[model samples]
Target: MTPDHEVLVIGAGFSGIGAALGLRRAGIDDFVILEERDDVGGSWYANTYPGVAVDISAFSYSFAAEPFASWSRVFPPGEELKAYADHCIDAYALRPHLRFNSRVKRASYSESAHVWTVVLGDGTALTARFVICATGWLTKPKTPAIAGLDTFKGDLVHTAQWDRSLDLDGKRVGVIGTGASAVQIVPEIAERTERLHVYQRTPTWLLPKPDFAVPESVRRLFRRVPATQRTIRLLTDVVTELSFVIAMVHYRRFPFLAKAGEAASKLYLRRQVKGDRTLMRKLTPSYRVGCKRPSLSKGYWRTFTRDHVELVTEPIEEITPSGIRTADGEEQDLDVLILATGFHVLDNLPPFPMRGQGGRDLKEFWKTERFQTYEGTSIKGYPNLWFIVGPYSFTGGSWFGMIDYQVTHALRVIGEARRRRATEAVVRPEKHDRSFRRNLRRMRNTVFLDPSCRGTHSYYLDEHGDAPAVRPASTYEAAWRARHFDLDDYSYER
Candidate 1:
């Protein structure tokens, strides 16, 4: 027999978990969390790559439902994050309503019934009044499409979908793309690999992480005095939020901050890499500081100091049978190849065939690269469907804060729906959506969206040369907006 629920949340990641918990808190327990994987922790479960850790601080990267006073490191590792998600599940008693190993294959809205008919991969059909697409942006792995890639004799892997069985000890390795994953993995591999060749499309601004372990005494003190930890977390969030003002307001006008960042990067380069000034120049980024995500790592810079590691900044023409070949007729052989190229972030929602009102597909409607919602949650045509960390909500600070805020907004919407006795509600107003996109385009002209950036093809920018993912200013502002979900912003139908 097919099961029925009031709300069905797809993918039991952080977002899905938040949605389920939020619904429960609002006295809506008839919702089920369907997870493709048997376990929770969406991205953290999939990515077990070496040196995989959160770039954001531990305090802000955690859930508001359950705060952790005993984080082992300043920047917690993947395992710790996964454990935290598990802890939330256990603490909230959310397992009873969760359906594991049930991947949603199709979701079609029935106009006659005013309900969503969702089909699982195993042919099980379920009905729900509302559907929450909590499948996160970074869950999918995007491997670069290179010629002769399949012909490679050695093992190939992506940082997101890492193969833990493969050994890198004493083996020649080739790493493609110097993005966030590359910055984290290269240092760990450099220690084990015989010869490591890093192919950089463009150099990124490497910032000092200042990552360190929290002492046992400090953890005990935090546990004893909760106010102290909260104060520290708030201070950190404020400082990080204020830093985005330069990128939002004076990107083009303010070259001083970018210059200072560059000068600092140069100093770090000089300190890390010796005996080769040309190599340092190649490693230096030509773009502004906030143009792309500035990577933070202690060992990323120090890894280049190793004798066996070589950083190659040549345009890759194609992949040969043995290894990768450059445009300048240079070819390098390797035993293993790792692609650290990021995910399909522009395509926030995948090709899952989502049909909104009037049989209009959401993907087709958003074809012009103007994927705007009222508050990054509800689309104009999509009724009763909410996106947790949707478009324009990509505040460069800690994502956890934003997720919490969105979850709260979603709960409020659900509460409103129940109170009004409405079957469904679409929280996007046409004017608000248009105005938000217009403001986003105007803001893109600033420093963060510099046209002359070394690598213009960033996750921050969409296909239409506009940065739709980044938030307007800071994390606090984002949280405030999310927490105060304006009913006026949404066009509700009872």
Candidate 2:
């Protein structure tokens, strides 16, 4: 039999687990969590590539309310991250309400009933009074276009869907893409692989990583005095949050900061890759540091200095059964091809079908009208449907930063709706949605809309080329706005 609930939370990653626990603390128990995976840790569980680790510092990248002072490194590894997710499940007693491997296929709202009918992959249907879509932007893997990909008589791996069983040791491996994943994977793989060919379309700024081990003594002290750990987090958070100002405001508002960043990055490149001017120039970015998300790595540049390693900046024309062919008529053979290509984030499309008012399909609705939302949480036509890390909410803040803001706001909305005996809580259609649309225009003036970003492959822009899929706000500002949000802007239908 289909189940019914007061609220249903989709996704089991950082946002989902955070949301579920937030509900429990709020005295809301009539909720369930549906996770597509059998386990928690959405990206952490799925991405088990050679050197998968968090790019953001572990000190500041954690949940603001829930701190783990025991992380081994400044940035935790993939396995450790998954372990942290497990800890949350246990700490919050979320296992009872957690439904694993229950992928939601579609969801629709009933205007008359004031409820949502959600379907699962296995054809089971359920109903809920409210829905929270926390399926994050980075869930879906994007496959790049290259001819003869299927014909290649070698193992192909997408970084997200990594095949743990397959071994690339002593193999001629060719890594495609130079994003965060490539920086991490290339260093690990190069040590073991016979030869490594890195295919780069455009190079990104590689900053020095300050990754280090957390001493046992520090952990012991943090365990004894929680306030000390919180202080560390506060300092780390302040430094990280300032990057938002540098990227969103200063880079465009003042050219000095941007020029200085470029100069420093060039000096760093020269310092890292000496005696190879061509390779150094190829690796150097022509764009600003945050034009595409700058990657931090201790060994990404040094890996290119290896005798057997080759950085191919030539345009790839097609793939052959035995090797990949470049547009310049050059060919490179490999035993394994790894795609460091990122997720399909800029599409702004839902993973499943979502229909709201008058049975209007969410995709069609977005297609026919402007993609609008109030404070990046609630939509006009979609009542009682909330999004975490949704459009304009990408503060480049810690995942916890966005998670905390949205979850806190959602709780307030839900608490008020239940207290007022309201069946539906929806954002006002015309005025509020229009205001956000105007704000989006202001974002176009930021660094993301710069000419350097225009041609680069980025997740920041949508298909229509709208810059900054996220709201260009600092973490502090986003949290403040969420805390001070007026429920009066939302309509409650009894």
Residue 100 lDDT (model 1): 92
TM-score of each predicted structure versus truth: 0.94, 0.97
Clashes of 1: 1
**Model 1 ranges off by over 4 Å:** 1-3, 244-256, 441-445
Return the clash pairs for model 2, or none.
392-471
Residue range 1-494, candidate 1, lDDT tens digits: 12388889988888888887787778788889989889999998988999999987888787765578879998989999999889888888899988999987777776656688888889998898888888888877787888888889898999998899999999989999888899899998898999999999888888778788999999998889888788878876765654554544356666676677667777877787774687888888777777777778887867877889988888888888788999899998889999999888758573377787888777777775477766667787677788776676667777777777778777777778778877767755665567576557657556655666535567776776666677665666667877775665655564
lDDT of 2 by residue, 1-494 (tens): 12399989999998898899889889989999999998999899899998999988887877867788789999879999999889888988889998998988899998988999999999999899999988887799988888888888999999999998878889999989999899999998898889899999989887778899999999999889999999998888877766544565435666676676677777778878875899998998877667677778888888899999999999889988878999999998889999899898746466888999988887776556645567877777899999886677767757788888888889899999989999999888774676577557667556777877777887876656665366777778878988888887789998
Evaluate model 1: give its lDDT.
Answer: 0.78
The lDDT of each candidate is 0.78, 0.83
Model 1 TM-score (2 dp): 0.94
As a whole number from 0 to 100, the lDDT of residue 32 in candidate 1 is 90
Q: CA lDDT of 163 in candidate 1? A: 90
